[model samples]
Target: MPSEAFDRFMGALRSAPCENPNRIGHAALRALQDSRIPEDALPCPELQREPCALNGVPCEWLRPPGAPLQRALLYIHGGGWSLGTLKTTRLFLAPMVRRIGLNTVSVGYRLMPEHPFPAGLDDCLAAYTALLEQGFAPRDLALMGESAGGNLVLALALRLKDEGLPPPGRLVAMSPVTYADTLEGSHTSLIPLEHILADDSFVVTKAARLYAPHTPPEHPYISPLYGALGGLPPLLITVGTDEILFDDALRFYQKARLSGVDATLLVGDHMVHSWPIFSERFPEAAQAVEQIAQFLQGRTP
Candidate 1:
């Protein structure tokens, strides 16, 4: 039997068909907005939410006022790297908010086609740098994301390390797309039957290509599998067994482990891309949330 959270999630997701191709282009972004669940359904947490704008970046921050700063999750939303918003992410972000018990700053990165390639990375980086400048310490920061957001989190970690800074407490990646442009594992017949990863990887590749028309397919930041994982922070990666990106997540974990980084790859037979939405009802989602919360807070105890 499907967990209640999973059932609720399916009902919500089934309200609309999620069909987004090419992480770029006007049509794709429109589809992303349409694919999202209802935004007003979530009850605002009592953490004293406040809104503020970064000086130059195109993103917004939701800071929980008067809360003691613990570790932070600098979130990068997924739209195949081309389209997504911080608002659309709340369907799943709420549970993470409660579980990890950290203030999350969801960066609305610039999407591809219009902003292309490093533009998305640049936006995410800007948000991180701005947070540091705004008085947040490195010891209390981590990166997390799903899909393209997953790729961005890893890339940002590398950039931060390359700049002679300490890595975040840890990193979490969900079904990241990290491979060559050929997309050997994403377009196979097995991926489409998966309820969550049913997204067409071929379309995703085309969208990525549209965003970074000039970049090579093997760029480490774009596809971290081709990059070195040396000096990476501890990683907690989750992907569904039936999703197209399953191999991508698995390969990343295997290679990261070989490179001596602490990484855990979880392939759930009953999961799909970013299933934390049914957080209140589903036992699995609840369990996953608690595990992440424990992982985030375990060291404190």
Candidate 2:
């Protein structure tokens, strides 16, 4: 069952496409500076927000259920790495933490065209390193992210392998931002969901350039699709069929199979990127969350 809120949002996204990527960036970045939810409507009661330093890197941990979740999640929000903060995700992260009984640390990494590439990756590695130093075992941690964050999670895993560091137990990637730059047919189809994704006249092709102005979109680390996957941990990719990035998910899945990696792609219908925001209203999102929670909780830490 689709929540009215999700349905309404989908309708509106289709009705009005944000005309400017700058505006999209501004709105999403601005939305982060303020609290987006009512205090009473906060999904988790046991949350502890604190300014913490990881390897001298600034990071915040949104502690979920304290019953020693035993497992920790290093969460990165999506905004093309140019925007998005913890606020963009807590609306769903809070519920996931409570339901799955996990401690989450959401990192607001430095943006691109300034602190581009390795900057964001550095913060993520520092935060993960800090968690490791805090007695969090490799098997007890999961690197999960969305869109750009999803790309970060995957890239971070590769980084760990390169450094000979123990990897996380598994990965939860949600509609990851693949492609180091524009591909031939990235996210330009889906006319039915263009409003949900592209801005007024903007397609994934245009968005890709703005999103990664400096880096080539096809860099293995940037796209992951080009990287060797022999050592990657199991992967769980959740995306929607109606969006432009669906092909990325599909392609990544096939590649993972070729590598003999344990991977699964859960495609949501009538849903767009990060549409799980409708968790409160959409049964599918709730069910999907439950599945992800179970996927994480079921693993032995």
Candidate 3:
């Protein structure tokens, strides 16, 4: 059973207003942008912020007080491919920065229904490459993301491997959408149980189509679960028992381990998708963050 606070949070989210599934293109973009957290109201006053462009891609560096410059993390924000922004994701990113005590670079990648599949992936690749060029060696850097961002984290690693670039020291993915070709497996059963996601609707699938209409969903870059998983860095994946993507994480972990990669999967019983994002109000969120911190610490030199 989940705690009282977790239950309450889910209730609030269930009651929150959502955009109509029929809306697409500019209409969907407008609705998502309108619903975002205002820029001026973003939290995390303790960390010094530096907004800059990395190889032409916009990114922000959030440094906790007294954080070591030697260690760095590239954080990709999630929005199911078409939504989410730096201001909207700061609530989660800020706390992770403080907990991990590293110079965290949050990438503001181009969104879908506008920039599309390769565009967002390109921006993320550019950001990672810029980080490497800036002197953060493979052993001193890590990659982390949630949802669509998590997908990019994995896709980026595979791209890096193909390009002969060294992998990051560690990787963390939370509730990632590993398979995009179909809504099969645990997705079908878990969606109805998860309060944050819809089961009967086509909203998510529509958004995915808008993002990658030309690309095959099963393409390794688009759906990393179908990609090669060997020789990647140590990985830590977290997912809630109630999320539609639970099977995605589990399958990825199993494949990664079979391929001889160091992989750890942490499942939060009765928790919703991206539970770590609610760290401000939930104990489970903090516990997940701590687990990620420990995992990263163990892999760090």
Off by over 4 Å in 3: 17-36, 200-205, 299-301
Candidate 1 regions exceeding 4 Å error are: 1-16, 21-42, 62-67, 186-189, 197-202, 298-301
Task: Please write out the lDDT profile of model 2 over residues 83-134, one tens digit for every residue.
Answer: 5555555666777666666777878777764566778888999889888898
lDDT-wise, the better of 1 and 3 is 3
For each candidate, the alpha-carbon lDDT, in order, equals 0.70, 0.72, 0.83
lDDT of 1 by residue, 1-301 (tens): 5666676766776676465453454656656674665544344465434444554665544445443565566888776775566567765675567666778877766776667889888887888877777777876787888888888888888777777866787888877877746657644645654565455433546656776789987788877888888889888887776567777888889999999998877666667666544466667766776766666654421
Question: Could you give candidate 3's per-residue lDDT for residues 176-198 as a string of tens digits?
Answer: 88888887887787767776656
**Candidate 3 weakest lDDT stretch, 10 residues:** 17-26
Screening candidate 1 with a backbone cut-off below 3 angstroms (N, C-alpha, C), the clashing residue pairs are 5-281, 5-282, 22-207, 23-207, 82-112
Report the error of model 2 at residue 98, Å.
2.0
Error of 1 at 184 (Å): 1.5
Full candidate order by TM-score, most accurate first? 3, 2, 1
Write down the TM-score for model 2.
Answer: 0.86
